[model samples]
Target: MGCCTGRCTLIFLCTLQLLTSLERQIFDFLGYQWAPILGNFLHIIIIILGLFGTIQYRSKYIVVYSIWTALWVAWNVFIICFYLEVGGLSKDTDYMTFNISMHRSWWREHGPGCVRREVPPPTTRGLEDHAYISVTGCMVEFQYLEVMHSSLQILLALVGFVYACYVISVFTEEEDSFDFIGGLDSYTYHHSPQKTSHVQLKPVYLSK
Candidate 1:
């Protein structure tokens, strides 16, 4: 399959980031959680700026976007490190497994209580149990997926920062070469010997 255009890819990623940031901001606000409030707000702003810069293709805005993205990479590193230090990977795995088991056990105990009265107990029992297991499995899968998504975002941001730097280098090189060529032309024109059009008239003498 052919790869998507860079502009399209950037727009897609920025849209995802914008949605993620907005969701986090809303959740935190509803929960009365202020610790990450500023961070989420800043992320929203930066993502919007990046989206605008990508669409506009302006060098100044793109340069700012690149710098912000680099900072975002650093922030992700800090977040990952904090998570690791607070709860190691093994601990996180165990926590997710624990949650899955708890959900499964809860469903096993309470599933019958929530079943519809019209459905026969025997026929619905097996189906209900299977549904609970499927739900638990999905929960476990999504827990790991979140972690993978965060890592992938960090990698993408780093790649974007590098690409922006390369673009800046290409622009800088072109400008420098143009100036160098112009300087050489100017120097050659100014320093080269100038031709004089004045010719000495010599008096013609009659040859003997």
Candidate 2:
């Protein structure tokens, strides 16, 4: 398990890289404007950190893997919340503008300037609040496929974590009867009969 830790760590790092690459492609296609230098620098830093962690803590790779997994999960939650809150600036749902518009209209209609003003769109409130757009506008909308992909990553991370825990238990537990095959041979031979000696033939030869 220790020896395989490095490979597992690399797999997780590559998954992160793939996600970032997809984000980059989406941003480029949308002609989205971001702080190119800063974004690139951050990407580089992430890669460097992953590589450093892999090299320096290969035996304890589970620690790095857990950190990365947590970060990824947190990032997903952040994206979900940001989109749901920002209305038109949502990164996931497509009907944000329409919903925001209705919300703003309702707000403006009930306000102090009701006599002279129509309701503002819901997004108008976000703009009025001067909320920071952050990195959300550049986020790719979460489609069914994207959700499935992310779900698979989360599942894989969980499986790896569980396996790591099992390995830890195996190492810590003081049991000499560690069944390597664990009844696998029994499963293979399932209902087959056991071999027996032919004692009748030996008896006949002795009588002759």
Candidate 3:
């Protein structure tokens, strides 16, 4: 059979279906609203291609062919961008930093940047030159949820890489088989024409 054809092709199809369904379930469990939008769209695409391969295209070669094509495309997307984790602001805050000890009026009156801007370190006199105040850091805005969501994409990308390797190995095996046959054909066709008829009928007599 051709690359990833027959049983291999069927295995790949089943795996894809299972993976897609599992992803949907996981997304739903996480209460991922965008899951339906993104996951469902990709799921539909895979179903259409798989359906075409299994029903319209009788050749398992074509089924695997479509899968390889899809895999490579997904691999590219994954390699290029999917794995990278990025951060973004979740919401805007009134001040860059907040100090619980300080009153809101004090912040508004002094101007908001860092709280230290309003309450600078005392350089002069009895405030204690050696006393250290534990200062809380800035109230930076970030989407913790987005960071978590991106982890799943990174995982899927890794899986896609493995799938690409599997498909590539299957394709290479078929290519090697074809190359071997082609080499045999090339050697015999040119060098053994006088014996070609004998060789052609040799198999029949051998089977007897």
Candidate 4:
């Protein structure tokens, strides 16, 4: 592999994936989106593994990473669909939180330039611990933001997958080209007969 090709490119892409996964993890944790949090955790770990495999030339690990990248792409696609409420998937559903809490995405209420206004309780009889605040004036909606994140992940995963496959092939070629026996003799560049230089040869003038 050249300085920026096969191995180097894969390593760099995996690093980028790791960073994005971490950023998504933090936001998912803040929003208490349990399912996404778990996914993000796994993504970060696998990305690290991918980086390790790329550096160490471990083909098995690279294979695992490539497989996971495919899965990650699918998972992100589902996220985009869920957020977009496509195929009758509702974002309001508590699936993200595992139905453990009513807490929603942090961006829902605190999106860019969003204002949260407290709603007056209709009755004193039934009031929850948390106040009801309506979010307004969001420059970008939370659903779109979520979709964007997923899109970016998908894009990175696709590129990473290609490079990973290339690296794996490269690793295989390296293994096949090198000979291993009980022990192999050292390589000598001059093992083949050296060519005699014309200047070092006896001149034909000697025939005169």
Index of the highest-lDDT prediction: 4
Per-model CA lDDT versus the true structure: 0.56, 0.43, 0.44, 0.86
lDDT of each residue in 148-206, candidate 1, tens digit only: 44576587677667656655555456668989999999988876534221223445689
For candidate 3, the lDDT comes to 0.44
TM-score of 1: 0.47
Ranking by TM-score: 4, 1, 2, 3
Per-model TM-score on C-alpha atoms: 0.47, 0.33, 0.32, 0.83
Instruction: Name the top TM-score candidate.
Output: 4
How many residue pairs clash in all the candidates, one count each? 0, 6, 0, 0
Alpha-carbon shift of residue 52 in model 1 (angstroms): 1.8
Ranking by lDDT: 4, 1, 3, 2
Residue range 1-208, candidate 2, lDDT tens digits? 6635634656565456546545543532243213222333454355445445445543244455455556655544443444345444444332323333222111122223333323544466554654322122222333333344445545554554555454434433423233545566675575343322344344554554
lDDT of 3 at 126: 62
In terms of lDDT, model 1 sits at 0.56
Model 2 stretches with alpha carbons more than 4 Å out: 5-44, 55-65, 82-208
Task: State in Å the error of residue 5, model 4.
Answer: 1.3
Ten-residue segment with the worst summed lDDT in candidate 4? 181-190
- TM-score of candidate 3 against the unseen true structure: 0.32
Tell me which of candidates 2 and 4 scores higher on lDDT. 4
Q: Candidate 1, residue 76: CA error in Å?
A: 2.1
